[model samples]
Target chain A: MARDTAREPVKTGPDYLEVRLGIYRGMVRVRYFEKRAYDLFLQNLVKGTSHLAIGQEAIAAGVAAALRPDDYVFATYRGHAHAMLRGAPMVAVMAELLGRENGLMGGKGGSMHLTYTEGNFMGSYAIVGAHLPIANGAAWSALYRGTDQVAVAFFGDGATNIGAFHEALNLAATWKLPVVFVCENNLYMEYTPIRKVTAVERPAADRASAYGLPPVLVDGNDADMVFETATRAVGLARGGGGPSLIEAVTYRHGGHSRADPGKYRPDAEVAEWLAKDPIPRYKERLLDEGVAAEVLERIEAEAAAEVDQATEQAKAAAPAHPGGLEREVFSDGGATWRR
Target chain B: MTYREAVAAGLAQEMARDPSVVLIGEDVGAAGGVFKATAGLLEKFGARRVKDTPISEQAIIGAAMGAAMTGLRPVAELMFADFVSVCHDLVANQVAKARYMTNGQVSLPLVVRFGNGGGLRFGAQHSQSVESWLMAVPGLKVVVPSTPADVVGLLAAAVRDDDPVMFLEEKALYPTSGEVPEGEHVDELGTARVRRPGKDCSVIALGTMADRALAAAEQLQAEGIDCEVIDLRSLVPLDMTTVAASVAKTGRVFTVEENPRLCGWGAEVASIICEECFYDLDAPVRRITTPHVPLPAADSLEDAAIPSAERVAAAIREGLG
Candidate 1:
């Protein structure tokens, strides 16, 4: 397969082109969903902070595509894209953001904390690298049980420096458990740039060698490139090739969360990344192929309509509060009841 | 089956039943664990299933959580219960809270088993009973089984449970023999069992302390003081009703725990008893527990730090007097 990087767009695997196209559509769904979420935040339709997965949807769509229904996945706070692409009902994801009873978590987890068990998206952790150990534990269990299930943990560049990331990687490497650590290196940790946070600058995947694991860096913004790399890694893990570290090098187009306007980053830096938007780049590739221009427009329209429906469903979802919060704690039958 | 044998059996049986239940910890595969709690696991399940991990608590727990969340059931053995501090966040914050925080989306279903409390004189670092600290966490289900039957029953229950469970098997009780019924069994959390019923007083005990309570109750029975001994099998979901009912019936209560006295597990039970059953009590609730000091290295000093049968018998008398 030739690498498509011209008027014909980037060369993709001809055999799996539809698979790539399907994933690209999922990416567009996430892209538009996040954009609508941002709009809702502006209108105060959502509560708490919304972590935008903008410019990073390709990573979620690509990685989640290769995972089995029973496989485990853990993500950071900016996890709407991961949850949605992993097959979490769009209604619940939107309802969770709206803090409604019909949400995936019944409104207990608003944005940073979202979970969908049916899709195997275990949770989107609010605490930086804390989910690393949990993901490791789940993978360890799968390997122990003799099943070839793999656990995929997603985090930002800032999390790489935390003790949990180091500890999880070291243990996963030592035990040779089936786990994949995908670091969405979006250049900045909230406001501080990656260079200012850690001494390592090449890519987050470079640190995998320190733990004796196979590490790879890929073009995070390209949906086809990300899909190919993730599929290879997922295949290797399911085949008992131990664990791998994938550093999807991309950029976050928005601020850290809903609160910030990203004033710290220069306008030119933002503009440069916007020019390389994942959705448009993939659309260009499809147009160059036999895909019709009308089809492209139809897909965009469908994605927008889906996003609008999810938003409306979220707005109409019921409220869940103290009662739902009390159910998951302690297995015992009785405890204090907060009215 | 002995408590130790029961644990090994539970692991072996779970491994055979589910392809997703894996046992990993230091010395767990070949060495059969430090306490020999996993004697034939490696041979029966193979190295891939029964793993011996490096001495990294954080890594071991983190990996276990990862495995469990991803659709596997991981049973991790921390060499000693005292070592739980090394990976407290994974248990308390991550594993314990993940399910609740995620609104019941992720169920840890992870079993963390280890020997707690002192009888072998391993000193402060290795002998501390820190189950109380874990009981405070909301998402964790704390199970401290005293007998082989309870161990087998509770182990099965914890394995099947969707929430993260902390199964604290007392080091002293592991070698002690007891009858565990054949086949699979399960015991629910937060239900206290009455070992020996009496009418005069309630002797509340947890873990190995329940054995001492039974001994004391037998001795006190000869002395014409009938005592009802309650074994608090689970701490997190405490059966306060049983304790309160016993206190209401006898009008006197004596609590025993191997852990220290100050801010210990006993304090929580004591407070609950005083709050609910104080009106029916004839005497103040007395606790026979370890002193507010680190577990001593010397056997004699260790004896002083931990509660004994004699100490429990005397506390029962004090409460009766």
Candidate 2:
């Protein structure tokens, strides 16, 4: 099947350069945060399991850079990057991962369920394909309330086969809802290559025609390309053009999770993707475009320092109190079910 | 008013009062639902609010959760209670845990209503009493209304409340008629109502079984066994205070359950009663429940599987003796 590359022309002006720099900075911040989380996991500071987006930072950064502050974003469990890019405090996200009191959800929700409603980063759903319909619902609410606030759902290539995926796309199309379905096609779903299990070659884009949506395919490693695609998609949605399906082609730099060594893929394939890593490649492009090296270095240094401070704060914070276990089960501020 | 009409009435009252309240389901709009309980809702609320979704339970429930999370108060109807299994993830993992897992940052003020239980003989797949399934889930408030008045009143309360409520309308009782209070009528959740007050024994039941328990109490009254029938309107908030109070007064208790015996709502009630009213009991807490088996399609087999009025009365008499 033919894949449609993002057609929004990249402007070459100071303003556009600033936007590119901002996207690059966003990606750098996410990259630093994820690396710090990986180190914390190794040191046993982060409990349970955490899904990292080490190589997939460009998609979150670019898509989020294109969205307005009030627009909703629903991401999958591998969502540290998405949360940070949407302006969730770095300290809170780090603390949440460490199960500390100052965590995003006061340590109630751990790594997989990061939610910062104040930032409009709706949630990071662990269940695959479940949030697609939910994103549609938020978009429906926006449409109902006469707001231009479009909703965006971010998932991996694996979610395309699930029943909720098809149901949500069709419903969004039928209702003409303002939402964008961004599939970070990371080539693999968990341990297996998505191609082996999925029927189609392009997991998300190939299935777009069935829902009457144009198949959108973008090079996920290129922040500029992702930004342009997302800008058009978000604009179209806000303009009442209904939903868009964009399959961002990328690869995870590490294993599916912390436990796996990612030995399933051929060494040659891993090296190929590593060579095309989005961060270094984008930084080199910015340098070639006559941007000062100090500008890029400053961004990287700031991001690293911010992540370091967050790590220290999270490590020093106390664990969530046990007495609050029976709270927030209902809206009444208590878990009481009886008189 | 009939229980079926009250379904529409309760929805109309809430939708009229709150603009955020919307209805979505399969055939819930122009078709008036498969059970015709939602008739005239589309004409009254218009297509914008009264949405007839495709035959997709996941989408229906997922959309409802999303809407509730944001601003809208959505009421989603699944044609049959058994269909909840198809979209159980949305209810159990997503909607039920969203508010808790998010630390109350997201509150899902939504309601999912379904036609529950066996009497229509729709076979194993269609005729299931699934309040027990939902009540086991922590974040959900499970409501099973026994009469038309309770249907209208409880539904109003469920819609108004800021939580996810699983509203189970007994399929067999949809045609049953009773007087409903005029105008805006709302009842509190987590409260039990005593249909018949007596001192000999307390008979506890849910949904359709409440009527059956009342009938059995009438039969036991004739036999000089004055029974108190308590209808548990909501299962999540088990209303153990009322149940324990009744058990204390009667000194003997019997639970008439339509669900399979194992881990039914009655089991929870029985355990609580034993714990709270251990000294007040004159007899062992007898549970009059259906044998643990799948409901058959045949009328007689279905009738035998679910505790009938005769079966309940006979169990009460045997236990008392």
The lDDT for every candidate, in the order shown, is 0.82, 0.92
Candidate 1, which segments miss by more than 4 Å at Cα?
A1-17, A66-71, A136-150, A266-268, A288-291, A321-323, A328-339, B10-21, B66-72, B160-162, B178-189, B215-224
Candidate 2 per-residue lDDT, tens place, A232-264, comes to 898888887889999999999999988988999
Taking the tens digit of each residue's C-alpha lDDT, what string does model 1 give over A1-339? Answer: 111211122245664666666777798889898998888888887888889998888889888877777888989899999888778888788888888888888887789888887877888888788888778777776766667777899999889888778888888778676788899999998799988878777447778789986568998898777876777776676667777889998898888889988999999999999999888988888888777888778777888899899889889767776666567654333233111
Docking class of predicted structure 1 = acceptable
Top candidate by TM-score = 2
Considering summed lDDT, which 10 consecutive residues are worst modelled in model 1 chain B? B98-107
Best by DockQ: 2
lDDT of 2 by residue, B1-321 (tens): 999999999999999999999999999999999999999989988999999999999999989988998899999999899999999999999999998889989999999999999999889999999988998888999999999999999999999999999999999999999999998999999999999899999999999999999998888888899999999999977798899889889899999888988999989888887887899999999998888998889988998899999999999999999
In model 2 chain A, the worst 10-residue window by lDDT is A1-10
The top-ranked prediction according to lDDT is 2
| Candidate 1 global CA lDDT score | 0.82
